[model samples]
Target: MPGFVHLHVHTQYSLLDGAIRLDPLIQKAVGFGMDAVAITDHGTMFGTIEFSEKCQKAGLRPIIGMEAYVAPRTLADRTAQDNKELRHLILLAETDEGYRNLCKLASIAQLQGFYYKPRIDKAVLQAHHEGLIAFSACLHGEIPRLILSGNLKAAEDAARWYLALFGEERFYLEVQHNGIPEQTTVNEALFDIADRLSIPLVATNDCHYLEARDVKAHDVLLCIQTGKTIHDSERMKFRTDQLYFKSPEEMTAFFGHRPHTIENTAKIAARCQVDLGFKGYHFPRYNPPGEERSAEEIFEEQVRSGFEDKWRIILQKNPDAERSRYLERLDYEIRVIQEMGFSGYFLIVSDFIRYAKTNGIPVGPGRGSAAGSLVAYCLSITDLDPLVHGLLFERFLNPARKSMPDIDVDFCINGRESVYKYVVDRYGGGEYVSQIITFGKLMTRAVIRDVGRALGIPLKEVDAIAKMVPEVLNISLENALKQEPRLAEMAQSKPEIGELIDICKVLEGLPRHASTHAAGVVIS
Candidate 1:
């Protein structure tokens, strides 16, 4: 049995649109004896690293890609008509250069091309097409749409244009079967076009959920996404229930007559090889003034001088205090920091904190494990003294862990923006800095309410059902149902309640949206 690779699948990081989660999705792929899978999340690479790592752990090759929203005109063109019209295209990374290009595209899409969605125009794609393999995506793709609209020549022209732009070897005509009547039409046209143009036909299932039974849950997810009830006459819906993670055997059965379509998936999967640079830290380069002292020397000098100043302040208050203990602890922590090759990291953080304090921005005393570091205290990165507090420096940064130390700094709400501005100014502004991304998930109670609403349950009833869920962090729907007997009884007694609970259970813990991380800003 020849295995088929999933080149166009969505994970929960696709937010409300995708129901399949990363861990279970990867596990399912491995269970089906799949050798490779690709996550083409909508307009973002948020899940690429996590998906790649999970796939590697499961002994499967991960193809990194995105189902990008391609703007009809230039990305800068935001006319009312153009704002709502965007086509779909799938871009897979074939090398490290492709991965970098993907990042650039995603960043530009979110930061500049974002109107109703993160979008990129063909111009942007042409500029960043190096090391990438592109697919004329699902029915929403330009070629497929053109074909479905009885525009065969236009469809062929569109396919030829992409083939020219991405190069003949890097472009593919994608075919899918999700039980939609229009898909059959599109696939037939694609086959004809592929035959004429010598373009390979790649089969994809467009997986949105893990199993066939998940169709109902995925439907509810779409309703939640569109703010509509399932009973609505006019609402966005998948025309068919065939969008599950299909096995190689199932895929072969679906496209067996055209075996090459199935085989091309494997070929495309083999071509993609992305390294996420997980082995080491890519810390931003710290440019020291005048080159008089290296970053390490300047870091040490600052730490020593700051420690002496603190020691002098303490000496004035308590003359009999032992300096040897403080000095030994400071030296040990400094040695550990230097040994870890984080001297520049410490200096960069300390420099910003100094700037914040000097400008009258109220910084917190200390927060998280970072307060445990004596070196942090010496550099004024934290105000808490580890010795007095009996905090272990190893907790913050240990030789055994060998990971980058996490230092979470809290700034006063009113002054936070100013501090961010100062960082941007110091680091050469937006070109060198950007905020990190954050994702929001479908928590147990929230999912229950959402599912109930989508199922057309009354708000009062939905609220009552949601209220039965225990207010506890990381508590699952199963745990809540077990803990609250009344909720279980209601689910068993009422058909609506039972359906809502079942749907919520499937959707729980899936990501609902993405936003900027509150406190994380990347310098470079």
Candidate 2:
């Protein structure tokens, strides 16, 4: 198998736009004894941190990167209120500095350069290229377009310019073979250019879907993206079914004639040592004026003052009940949080929630575990007082079950960004806060549908068969066949149908994608 590691890979975080799921990719990499794998999702680094952790857990190295669009100018100009097409390049973060640069580059592209695609120009690249690796990516790259136009010399010059921009050792010329005629031509010219510049060569599968069978499902995705039906004459199409995560044996067979290309993958992984540690606090902290006090102290002052204010309002509103009960509950809850070593946690939560209320972000009263805390209610961290709402304090911060207090605050969807920004601007740096990363897995139904399409089956039939499968998390084909009388009857009635169903049932539920989870944040 040589030293092959998948470099240009995508996961579901490419958002229904890519096919490779997580479990199988990790399994394949670990099973094959492959050292590392990279996920360069189109235009986003959303999967970078999640992929990093999963690969590490799987004992496979994860290279964090993104396949970013190269804008024609600075980010703001490109994403102005106009549609535009731009060249693409692959960027991999080789270190933490590289990861930060990648995040900044991606943020700028989306925030400023997002007219048609998130893009950045040469100026952005030159500024953010530190600790990063670059590749003259797929046929969509500037260099590949030049080569295809039969301007080899100009392509060579373009290659040199990229090398200069990203540093000679940091840049490589990519060669992919999806059985496209133009790819072969591009490969030949790229090889020639690589030799001239003495830059390394990397082999990638450009895996948009997981298996050969997914070619058609991906085609369907292309249709979905273009708002065209399968039968539309102008629908976009891939040149080959070869754009899948081929097994090491299949890849070995495909490029067995050229060992150097395959070996280059391992070489690149060895050089890419980006360590993504789980940084703490998804929320940024509020800094007090003139360094007058630490975040912790300031937070405590706010919580105590807020608690007193809220307590006065509550007692005045309800003068009938014995005050001892409320006082006793508060004492118990505060003691539990203090013993759990999460008073700071309470302080942090109270601070931002108070800020949100002050700034007019409509926060949910309280949700999930935080609904039961008397301290939370007193501090205005939750609108519903536990006793008043018939909620048990143990449901939130259980004395018997010591764990981090789960305080989830929901804000209006439109203002979540400002809330998140407030958190970032106040809390994090080298020590305080960063985004929590997540991974989405490729499951059975998608793999089955994707595989069926790649084999070039009729769309109506595939859609019908898929519909027979229930719309639940990880629904099984066996269950679908059993539950769907028509599907079982079709399998029994038609031989080809039986084989197709059998093949898909087996391939279903394998890793299909990697994506961020909505509304889940973790702090460490």
Candidate 3:
């Protein structure tokens, strides 16, 4: 049988929807003799970097992509009457330009187009379609929905529109054989459209888990996602168990008659070549207000000026304070920061902290290794004197580390928004600034409680089971089962207890939801 790539694979990063982890997914792909896999996680590219790096190490090509939600009208439109429906589209980056465009589209969806889900409209897609390969995604995709609604002309028009935008070589009519009754009808219609428009058809499995037996575990994950019981008839569920990652032979079994469709998966995977340019310095440019001096010059000037002011107060507090030692430390730090290409970073942090203090917004003196920097103390970014406390500046900004220095700042909850606004406005506005995204996963104890609740288990029993999982940080379910003999014995003695533990074990560590990082923000 000819080799086939699983282009619609989702990993744990899909956030409670996908049950497959990257390690097992990579293992399965290699074991199946396939050379590539695609991660089309719903509405986010959270897993792309990890996926790309891991796949390259394992000698498998990672096609970085997202299963994006498209709005019915303009992305900005939000109304109860006319704009509730969302369409799915799979977008893959074919080059560095495509990767950038894909990132732009995802950010626009997140910052501007969010409603029930992050979404984009055709207008934005058209504006940023360069170097991208688009696919009419699963059953939820635009063309499939149009075909299902008995509007062949609209479906054809939609296909042609994408074809014209991405160019014929970059667009494909993606078909899946998941055994959903609608998919059979959708695939037939897609084939008819593909023949008429001369557009190629590509087959994918829309994989959500790793294997056939994992279907039940994935179902439990869906229950946790929807807050529904496995016994609930109306809860959201997959219609078929065919959503697991299938081997090339298995996929060929599903689409044996259409060899070209199977072959198209490899073709698409080979075409997508994205270089994320990892480990490059990406600090935002910080130009001082109305000053023609370079960042290095401005940084040194502020450090020396602030040091003199700080030293004067130090002399008043302690008449024996050594001015030369302070000056020497300040000069050393400035040189290190300048040589490391981090002068702008220090200036940016100092600017915001200064703004906070000037405006009566409470700020933490400093925290972590950042307190070890004399530059931080001079700039008022920290309150502690490294010399008095015997702190090492190299601990904060070691040249040997060869990574960006981290400085953690704390601000009054009520006034932090103002500080953020000041930075945004000072930099370039929302276009150049955004908050970082963080994921909350289903930890061991929390997963037990959640699974028990979804299973309709009594609160007392569920709480007892959850408490049995040791209160250690980031403990896994398997470890908990082994560490607590009572838990393992209960699992063996009682079937319901065994079932509850079983489900929780599989659902643990998958991302439960996404939220903005509390203290971190990204600036372009």
Candidate 4:
């Protein structure tokens, strides 16, 4: 009864659209002694890695899910003819297959159905919705839209469709109330439909950020997103002052009259028995033909070939620059690559890059520590030469410690798929290659700012106070206030300032959502 999980959350993985910061949100949830939390970021699972990593470290149950935008029809609907826009759908990975389906669904949504946001159609859902728990999402959710349009029968029909896809036990009616009039109207009809259909009901706060007061900054953020002034009535919006994270106590109080709704939240959590394990690396595959050579052999060939070519460059450039310098570096790099058992990784990257260059793909000159290797230069993995650029090969491969050497190759965004395809073709693509997952945690400062604003903080005051704290990434407001004299002075001089920083200190660093990294493709 005391511990409650945040079932719906959005961290910055919602990008600028979500104000929640991961560190603060997770910390706050723990501080409040909450049991578990769900990260249902809008559209993409970009934050999954960060969120899950932190949650495991902090001993919190991390629920992985996405607030998907449903495409009106199939994303393959190629007629430029305007189609009725789709609704919001909440998809949670309940099993390994569900997680995989979620990834494919998210990928396809971005690749094929990107209209206003990443989206998937009913057809796509029909294919991959198995093993996923479905929730009828925010007011913009499909069933709510039907009810809002004054069609109770239509709303029931929509619920029936989801119930059929996910089964009664796996699908829940997501009811939220942020004091919006539309929410009130929809809840009434939603409950009616759930009762008629014999479907379960769950309560969600539709948390956009961490705190209520953050609503204003989030409003300002909305302004930033749309290029609209804060005063515009025509702007697309959240439409409520009440979307901040509420404590279990507060949540219970909000649904005091409807205790069943509050109880249902815990019931849904009980039904959601998901255990996440980070047992193996989700490496992108480096395929090779079984008849030609084993993957290991192909990989070793690339490294040996790369080292010889690098020796050539060094010998040519510094005919007398010390042969020991070239040999010592090459021997060390090769040894480390072999020891880590990642010759496959190096070869896989090299093969694709070689193909790209041969096809005139205009790959990046170099980036990261890989730019510092002579072997990389000679093998065409990178254009930068350590001998010329005075780069360090140790940065790429350190003999002192072993870690995967991350060499990112960038091509024109439009033609990057060809490069991806080449790698998939060479390395066993589908089974071997898998994208890494990350998560977004809520943190202090941001959450308190959100809570303060939701309860109502003047914008000018919030800005002035936020400016007083020194800007340091990854430090909580509590630490910032203690370390910085300026923040200490400001808090002492102003009572409201003290309150603002005080509350943010409590809510700092909770896992508010999940999202994917931009280019953190893991190659094993």
lDDT of each: 0.89, 0.74, 0.88, 0.73
Error of 3 at 85 (Å): 4.8
How would you encode candidate 4's per-residue C-alpha lDDT over 258-372 as one tens digit per residue?
A: 6777776665555555555565334454555554675566665665676677667766876777767666766676666667676666666777788888888788988998998
RMSD of each: 2.0, 5.8, 2.7, 7.1
lDDT tens string, model 2, 1-524? 45678889877667656756777778877877788888998888776666778888888888888998886555556344323447789998887798889988997786667766777778888889898998889998889988998888888888888887777678888888788999999988888787778977777888887778777666655654555656667667777888888766676667776677788777777888765656433333344557667554554555556667766777787878556777787667766766666666777677677788898989999898788887888778888878877888888877787655678888888777777777666665423444554544434556555645655567787777777777776667777777779888988998757766765654454334444556554433
Task: Output candidate 2 Cα RMSD.
Answer: 5.8
C-alpha TM-score for every candidate = 0.95, 0.76, 0.91, 0.70
Query: Number of backbone collisions per candidate, in order?
Result: 0, 25, 0, 62
lDDT of 3 by residue, 1-524 (tens): 34799888788988889999898899889998889899989888899888999999999999988898999788667886324468999998888899999898988888788887889999999999898998899988989989999998999999999898888878999888887999999999999989999998888988999989888889888988888988899989889989999888878888888899998888888988888877688889887668898888889889989988888878887899888888888888888899999999999999999999999999998999999999999999999889989999888989777777889899999999999999899998888898888889889988889888888899899999999988888889998888999999999999999988887777888889989898788888
Model 2 stretches astray by more than 4 angstroms: 72-85, 249-259, 303-348, 351-367, 372-374, 383-404, 410-478, 491-524
Highest lDDT scorer: 1
Comparison by lDDT, 3 against 4, better one: 3
Q: Using TM-score as the measure, which candidate wins?
A: 1
